[model samples]
Target chain A: MNLPAGETRELLAAEYVLGTLPPTARRRVERWILLHPELAESVRRWEHDFARLAALATPEPPPARCRRRLENFLKNERPRRRLTLIAASFWRYAAPLAVAASLFLVVVLVERVRTVERPPAGIAVLVGRHGHARWVLTMGHDRMHVVVVGRIALPPHKSYELWFEPRAGAPMIPVGLLPNRGLMTARLPAAVYVRLAHAHLLAVSLEPAGGSPTGRPTGPVLATATPQAV
Target chain B: MASPPEPALPSPPPEGRSEDPLAAAFLACRRQDPRGLEKLYELLAPQLFGFLRRMLPRKDLAEEALQDTFVNIWRRIEGYDGARGEIRTWIFAIAHHRAVDILRRERRLVPTPDTDLESLLATAPPETAHEPLAQLEETRLRDCLGRLSQDQRRVLFLAYYHDRTQEEIARRLGSPLGTVKSWMRRGLLGLRRCLETP
Candidate 1:
């Protein structure tokens, strides 16, 4: 059963502050807190309450190797381009943010592919309702990769399904559920469309079973994309 | 002759930390100052590291995860919204998740001994331990902790140290999720009540 609005939120927020909420539950509540300011305020009160509990633990020094590894990682992380600043004219700024977001996951995914040694795969971009990338997809014969770097707004009672609209001669297949955080990769069928400009459309359909049913999209189209050349 | 000169003293309000320069600096780095991120790191490293050390079984893993946590914090500072949670909570949440993720990935169990309450007593630094009165307070606090039900303390410790999700804690303790959650809420409230009653 779903929880009621405020009182239950406080109870859960306290548990979250106490560091007792389940990971899934915590993720859910965190999303809710992001949307609702009041719930977040409840969390703040509890955060201060249990904040001192850490004092009870004895400090353990880390091994020197770990620090060195982290230092190296930091030194190596190339800073990506950030979104442009806001100004009196949001209209002037909107397109750039959308364009930057479109390339974001592709940039990260491409970089990761080079260093991490993943296989050549098929990719699809899941754009937000307004044409920003809610996620990006890269599918291999056995693994599906989805990177949700941009803002994704899912309906409360439903979820967005990722569908591979293969060419008229091919078939549509289910990939996997999209996450709210960093990049994700899972197993998939194979590369169906090489050039996004030429082949099947990657589309979002709101549906049940945590994904699309009836083998076709059933909800308002959120976003679609073509492949980017590596 | 004239009215007595007003006393020239304006003491800062005791509870008013309104101008949290540190938080302000975090906000600034969040806005534009890159050094602000490093300053935040310097401020928060101990708390983050100390918390992680308690949760992980080994030091190396904890430290590795802590580094990732800080790196993410530096990179994702703009995503931090002060309105949602405590800056401390937000920072630790990242650290906590990294620790949990590492544990899940490695599939390792945290090693914790059956600690005796008295054995846990840490005599503070000489400056504080030198004072018999401070020692007395520490003794009293330990005694108060000792009075807590084992379940209560376990829940409290698990929450504080491991930052386990309620589901994980419940599964580990073999208690219902609701029971585990309420224990964290009321049990912590009880501890506070007990500690504050001078």
Candidate 2:
């Protein structure tokens, strides 16, 4: 389990490259490679050996959306300390204004709901990588209601951050960090709501407990969903 | 073990070359040149996409894995050491890992087909008319791969291309678990020897 020796190590390296190793054994070998330089060399050799076979596959051009997405990701990945500082200032002034705006919107939304019986404007069921529905978001006129339908175990120090990805080439806007469980309402600002109206997809990524230190996502994106009219 | 009869494969085209540009791009990416990253994508995305397409069941899923692979490569590029292996191998490792993750996730949702092994093994490799490799490398690899026993070839193909676990392969092929493991080990060993010779 620690460090495989001799022929065993070579076989393990090959199996690892071959994708036949079980998850546990695969993790063990990966860790072993980091600790022992010789094992790493062995794995590299095996990787090169099989790489030739990879060429046998017919090349496929990825979808146009893929290039756009990668470009956007790379753009967001740039260092923007200045932008983060501006965001901090903007949030400071906007927080109280946002609270007052939400209270007024809630009253108006409540009145409208009583006057007319209508379904949610949009609904998105965000499924995790495992295909389990994890979060359900219902878009109202001025607010978005999110419900955690399934439990996503997270490190105590980590949290799930949500973003609204507009259909246009706009950068992903930070929505908010999802609570560990249960329903949480986010009062969407007019700018965000306007963008959300045109947005087709919502993305959720895992970030630090407080949320992304960077203005943009700094961790693995867990799921994405396109909201449907309901 | 006696080698299998070699198939008559056409000489590969001369267009595709080595990984030197990719390696240089990696170096530039390390220095935070965004253009270098874009160049790397242009050079490698097709090859990675091809591998992912065969590995995953759906094209959309393959695309998602491809995106994730590049994102991960960008994030982890700082840790890349050229001395360990070619950037090509490292990139493929990341992509293959991503495809396997998707497969595992999908497997959890639905049971794997028990007869997929037979069907996949029976199917021929897709024709390379549209996408040919370098002539010498292609000829050498095809000849060497053809030399492997049918069982060895099948096992290696399923393992490398489809990301099938030995246990799953055993169930799919209707063979004993131990036999499947032996086939995988022997297949890889045979391939290593065959490729090493000449």
Candidate 3:
């Protein structure tokens, strides 16, 4: 589609800078700005002009807790940076190991194809402390199908719960409770679906018979799995 | 590694109040100084939080946006080129973009029935009176905004302050989407012409 001409183009840029363009249009303009210097210049000009409008709003200081939150974030950031570097190094050394593991997982998945209903958008294999796969999670269109693959033993009145971490260092959201045997399906909420779109990790925590009473996990984490899109 | 020692925390000045402190804090942030990040947050948080509170629907969302804005500023400080524009503008742009992202993700970009456009226009006069050029720019903006028809001004205000999309603005005003788009375009064009005039 042709870019809006002359005055329309400038106004579109103004809307983009003002943050009113719909997602798709905003994304299209973002790509357009990269290819068109004039569009990019207009965006920059509008950014400068609209920056003053921010002053038109009353200046209310953020709550005091916000400072404490920032302090905690900064404190965690340094260690996370180091962890990222270590992760990079680990990926370099463990590349072949990960490839082998992926091939093994594929073979297992192929063998279990008769049990799975449809093609999965993503999958994760949660393992126990002994390095054995305890459960397999397959993400479908609007549900997560989980299958217990290994023998699990739990104390009385205890169950395992699933949690999804959309991004590293972000809080984990409780997905659902894990079944000790047989298949279980957990429906996904729109918010959860949005979060799962960018999720990288899944974990299992031992909880009460029903699930975590609190919205958050209240038990010791038992296992973690790296979620991968198929 | 040990974190850098933090300097004393001074109360943040009002919006458009002090440039030197913000610039200094920005420079410190560029150097990877924690103190600078602290100072920058102190300096920018008040105005940014207020701006975000108006842009987002909920107080918690505004607070999260404010926090994310600082995180982005800290992470991307190395990429910031001073030649392009003032750091304050750049910071506001970051916060605004973050707010939009949240609005889109949460699907909160709906028509807000109770947005008081008149009060929005009446309150929050720029605190830049001490700085003649900034005050002049603010005055020119207010003047140019005043020149537009109420429809045009309302469209701009809803989009800018309330994060309303054109469709939402149309719904809010009981007008056609095409009409809302024209109002936005004409209003922006009129403001540009007026502000650009010497």
Candidate 4:
């Protein structure tokens, strides 16, 4: 027996707002809310109703120092945020220069590697549904390089996150977020390096900006690749 | 045709109107104004703290949740969509979520005496209270909640007020987990049907 989709969604939404859903399930529901506006509305309505019920708890004034602590936090946080904004602006201006430099570096690296023909530790070419290579990942001794091959149509407010599945039906461990364009280089974490040796497949999923919130993929798997040892 | 009338004096906001007083302060906080955060803290801290104190067993834990909730409100204010709900709901949701997180981490129960179920069933808002519409809504909710079976009501209240998981509620009531889940589902459906009645 199965519940109608709407009823099931409503129940899930209620449970989500009630704080009854387990942590992983809760994260899944949050992602569902993002993908489904109706679910979001249902969750919001439940939140409003429960918030009203929560108001039934008698109101007792918090100690005065709580206020002082918050004020102090804000005082410290403001300058830090301002500094972050300044750094953001610096990135805004430096982005084009950095892109140019990276492009040049890519060209030089690709040529030198082709001539040297040194076997990469491992390599994988992630392909889209059409079987066209979308990204090429190469694991060197200590660094992993992910380079977008062509114009990949990326959804707005979404990023492509990479993961290494150690074996069939095993927990997928997050490797890194893939760039929409150009190249991303990161020093391989020891765990990732160890997993790469036995990884069954490499996968990419569409996630919100900055990557998966739940430490697991919560969106559609857009591409996948199998590592080949040279 | 007549002489200019005297300038209209500013009148106080209407009584009994359900208006969001925190909306302006929320907007300012979104813009990173420290003063706006101060105003919000002044307005909401007491009520939020009170709610947290009830949710968490210890004063320090509740206070910790309160601070984290405010910091999250300021940082994630951009995520709040005015079209979806009120600022107050968003704020309370953050606070409630934080409290639940702490509750799960602590895994300790607050000491709630065996409450008189009859009193809760008979609960009604005081007529003298302001915000009649809100009071009416609360009354309707309470009435509907009262109608649920005692077990169902207890399960719902355990989850809602005490942040108890279904497993915990089951253990606490000596009921099977499946039974507790059914009670919760049926309780929720019944409440929804009652509240949705025009």
Q: Write the per-residue lDDT of candidate 3 for residues A26-139, one digit (tens) a residue.
A: 756754664476887888778877877766677788999899989888887762243336667555544445445555655666565565455666667775555556777766
Which digits, one per residue and each the tens of the lDDT, describe model 4 over residues B1-198? 222223223222222133544655666786788887887887778778877877777889889999998988877665455555666676788888888778777764655433433454454443314335556777787888878898888888888877778998899999999999999999888887888889
**What DockQ would you assign to candidate 4?**
0.25
Task: Compose the digit string of candidate 2's lDDT tens values, residues B60-170.
Answer: 888999999888777666555455555666678778778878888987776433222334323445443432433345456677767777787787787777777788778
Best by lDDT: 3
lDDT of 4 by residue, A4-97 (tens): 2676788899998887888767767754554466787888788878876765555667888888889889878853354226757555654444
The residue ranges of model 1 lying beyond 4 angstroms of the native Cα positions read A1-9, A18-38, A60-74, A77-80, A83-230, B1-38, B108-147, B163-185, B191-198
Q: B82-111, model 3: which lDDT tens digit per residue?
A: 545677777888887788778777664554
Q: Measured by C-alpha RMSD in angstroms, how accurate is candidate 4?
A: 15.1
- The reply for model 2, stretches above 4 Å from the true place, is A1-8, A22-38, A80-230, B1-19, B110-139
Please list all clashing residue pairs in model 1, or write none if there are none.
A20-B166, A21-B166, A22-B166, A142-A187, A143-A186, A143-A187, A144-A186, A144-A187, A196-A227
By TM-score, who's the top model here?
4
| Winner by DockQ | 3
Q: Which pairs clash in the backbone of model 3?
A: none
Q: Which of 2 and 3 is the better model by DockQ?
A: 3
lDDT of each: 0.57, 0.67, 0.72, 0.70
Relative to the true structure, candidate 4 reaches a TM of: 0.62
Residue A64, model 2: lDDT of 87
Candidate 3 CAPRI assessment class: acceptable
Consecutive 10-residue window with the lowest summed lDDT within model 3 chain B: B2-11
Lowest lDDT block of 10, candidate 2 chain A: A111-120
